[model samples]
Target chain A: MQDPQSQIVVIIIAITIVLLFIGILFLVMIWSYNNKKLQMAREKQQIQDAFEKQLLQSRLEIQEATLNAVSQEIHDNVGQLLSYAKVQLNIMEQQATWGQEELHAIKDTIGTAFTALRNIARSLNILKHAAATRVQIDMLYLPEQLQINIHDNGKGFNVATALTNKEGLGLQNILNRARLMGGAATIISQPEEGTSIKINVPYA
Target chain B: MHIHLYQYTQFLSLLVAILCYEGLCKYKLSAFLPMLVIVNLIEVTGANYRALGYIPWLSNHAIYNLNLLLETPFRLYLMGQMLRMRSNERLTFRGIAFLCMLVILLNYLFLQGPFVFNTFSLILIQILTIVLSCFILLRLALREDIRPNLWQDPYFWVNAGLLLFALITLVILGLQQYMQDHKVMLGGKSLYKAIMPLPNFILYLGYSYAFILCRIPKARSLLSS
Candidate 1:
């Protein structure tokens, strides 16, 4: 027969083993539970990202269509009206004798106005091209951060000069909007070069 | 030298910790390196004190009792740091550790003395450790941010191992006197001698795995919160 001390030690060990097994069981249950939660969270995030991407695509399509409509209006309606006025002014100058200087000045003013309207129509067309050309939007998900990149193969302007001058208001608006959303935007462009805009935001 | 299985496991854990020192340092867990070294030294010396012809006064029981006085509080502090406990929680843990240390000193000086195994203090420390480990595990399980990479977390493994070790030791030591009085036996040998080392082995193995996990590049980011 073993001594009482040894017997006690033996019992302690036996009971300990049982308890350890129980402890292990608890750990395994926690692990399994947490893993399920993590998987569910990942799936939810994926769904949200897909939804956001779709929403963005729809918004872009609507914006493109609106720009196209405006471009067409300026080129077909307003542009033709300006040209007709210029032609009328020219005919009036050819027929009138009195107030000839005034008529010439009027004709020159109309000619300048026609040229300005045409320039405006051409600028709208360029904007339409930018909206319709090869444009790519990529959404990159990082830990706690979301990055978006928009690229367009359209005639690009000097980013530095545009940002410093009145022409940069559109770019400034983009930057300001991103900042309002707790994000930042970066635009990369050069004359005749493609444009790429990157925005980074933090999300839970 | 005839190294015990438990000792071998300890060495293996130490080796893994050393191998992952760079990664551990990056995460500010370099303390584990010295802690493991100290634990191995204690284990080796305690096991081979007589053969090495150490002073008669420095018995294994006395060494272990001293270790208990020091190790328990240190471990609590480390756990608190790993869990990123708030200031209030940290204060509470520090208070508990201080109280435990005080109790251990009183028990050593007046109650059990130094010659005998400080079973009372051991049980108290083990119970406290079990509670702390449970709290940590619960916190980890409930945290959504860490849930995605829970398995890769070194603290999860460390806490799990600690919980298991504390639970087993608490049960075994708590019932030691009762079993001894009853002459309990298993396979004609004292069950304590046969199985006591198992928990240590399992714990060290878990630690080794945790150190390996610390080497993962993403571990730092996962633990940043």
Candidate 2:
């Protein structure tokens, strides 16, 4: 019973409405997709920053741990040996039975102690030297590895103590540096013998 | 059996829905798949009955009317669970569902009397469903801090499909009686017939795609913001 023209108008209106609704759906879809992409990008950036910050914190912690161990070593082992040497010198000076041989023995002992003190001072000064000097670095034809040997003809230290002491960074720092370069550092020494420090480091 | 394109699509959708049951359960969307399967089965049964030369109850509309009744509550359940995940909206979809169910029951008991097609209840359910679907879509679109990739989100795809289905179906159902009375209202018989199945096909296709895409990667499991 509906008029033909009225029915045509209603159908046309319905189709238009449906098409407009579909358009709105598509607009919403595009907006949602873009918003999601932006959110993901923001999340990825936050994750990257968090990872970098953690890496920096851990590196600083390693450095701090090494420094604390080194400070403890200086106060304990090296200081004790130096104090013992001073006590021996004082005893030799006070004793009346001290002869030329005794004097020579004391003199040799004092000389050995002085050389040890100088070695400790040089080791302590190496960091300051690195900071002050801008040494020329050769990058041309860089080898796969570069080996450095440091030898000293002085009364040797306890290799076991240097390697095992928890409160010592002298040898460990060298090892850590070598490891960072994808290489290694090895120490060979014995009591009353000479000492050798070997460093094998990789370079590009 | 001479199965047509619609039947083939329906079976494929059901297969995919079953296979993605794990992903559905993870997001509490498992209830929807069973309801879908039941609806499909009812359609297939109705089709078989007609093909066998048997007169279907109320000319095959009883089964469809039953589908209408079952589908609304399932949709409300899905909407409630989906919203519970993404928003803090104190929705009482359960109460709305119970009320709609009562309305349908009253129509079936008194008005339509269940022997004939429950046209009143059918139209009512369709309108209510369309309104609920729109509400869900609005909440989802305006809600802040949704999944970073809404495409991969099962609920997003599900609700999107529901909204699409509801929108198109609303127009179809609203004009059903009018179109039946006046077949030439939409240009011709062919156009109306073609358009009727299109929304249903699109709805199932969307659900299948959603099932396949609904996975939370182990690293990306921390959803939304």
RMSD each, Å = 8.2, 11.5
For model 1, which pairs clash?
A: A8-B179, A8-B180, A10-B191
Best by TM-score: 1
Q: Report the error of model 1 at residue A132, Å.
A: 23
- Please report, as a residue range, the 10-residue window in candidate 2 chain B with the lowest summed lDDT: B216-225
Question: What's the lDDT of the predicted structure labeled candidate 1?
Answer: 0.76
Candidate 1, DockQ to 2 decimals?
Answer: 0.43
iRMS value of model 2? 4.2
True contacts kept of each: 0.74, 0.00
Colliding residue pairs in candidate 2:
none
Clashes of 1: 3
Docking class of 1: acceptable
User: Can you write out model 2's per-residue Cα lDDT over B105-185, one digit (the tens) per residue?
Assistant: 887778776555666776676667556655655555566554455555565566666666666666565555555556644
